[model samples]
Target: MSAFLADRDSARFELRFQSLFNAGHVVSFPCNAAGQVDLDALSERERDRYLYARAVVGGVFSLPQKQRRLD
Candidate 1:
């Protein structure tokens, strides 16, 4: 029983970690090598979206993994 519970818990933890890693990849794809958006190259609307993404990604990665959340 304990072994089964441990296995299930490990699976859940790995799933969560994979999701976060995938999200990091996605958020990373949009930015340049320096991890910054090129505001001048973007349209006004795109600039807004880029800025928002930057802030959200920055905050998420800045916090401890346990405390990371979009909210």
Candidate 2:
């Protein structure tokens, strides 16, 4: 239940991320310890996509929880 929805959400987020990544809006997706995007490393446009992806992923996306939280 939750897992499936989570997977779906992740897929959607990945799609959105890829769209911007391919569009050259994001150079790299350097995440913090908690796996969220490291805004310090991202430009304003990249940051927007990152935040959008975060929302699409239901705010549960990260690089494996090994990175620190972005905010």
Candidate 3:
């Protein structure tokens, strides 16, 4: 979905990731703010925050802070 990724960028990324894997490189998966690794199991609040974060990272949103301001 456009909410997550565009097909072209997504496809390119998949190819790159596959190449890395084929070359025996390990890709570090994404983790949440609390360092949780599972995405599909995220709670409602965590899911919302995660989507906002994904949007920011993918250049779909500008949240101002370069790093998360979690103090």
Maximum-TM-score candidate: 2
- Candidate 1: where are CA atoms >4 Å away? 1-36, 58-71
The best candidate by lDDT is 2
Tens digits of per-residue lDDT, candidate 3, 1-71, equal: 33233223322221111121233631222333433335554567766765555554424433222223222
Clash count, one per candidate = 0, 7, 0
Ranking by TM-score: 2, 1, 3
Clash tally for model 3: 0
Give each model's whole-structure lDDT: 0.36, 0.41, 0.36
Q: Report the CA-based lDDT of candidate 1 relative to the real structure.
A: 0.36
Candidate 3: give the clashing pairs: none
C-alpha displacement of 55 in model 2, angstroms? 0.6
lDDT of 2 by residue, 1-71 (tens): 23333332222222223333233432225543234443554578878866665565423333222322233
Instruction: Give the TM-scores of the predictions, in the order they appear.
Output: 0.33, 0.36, 0.28
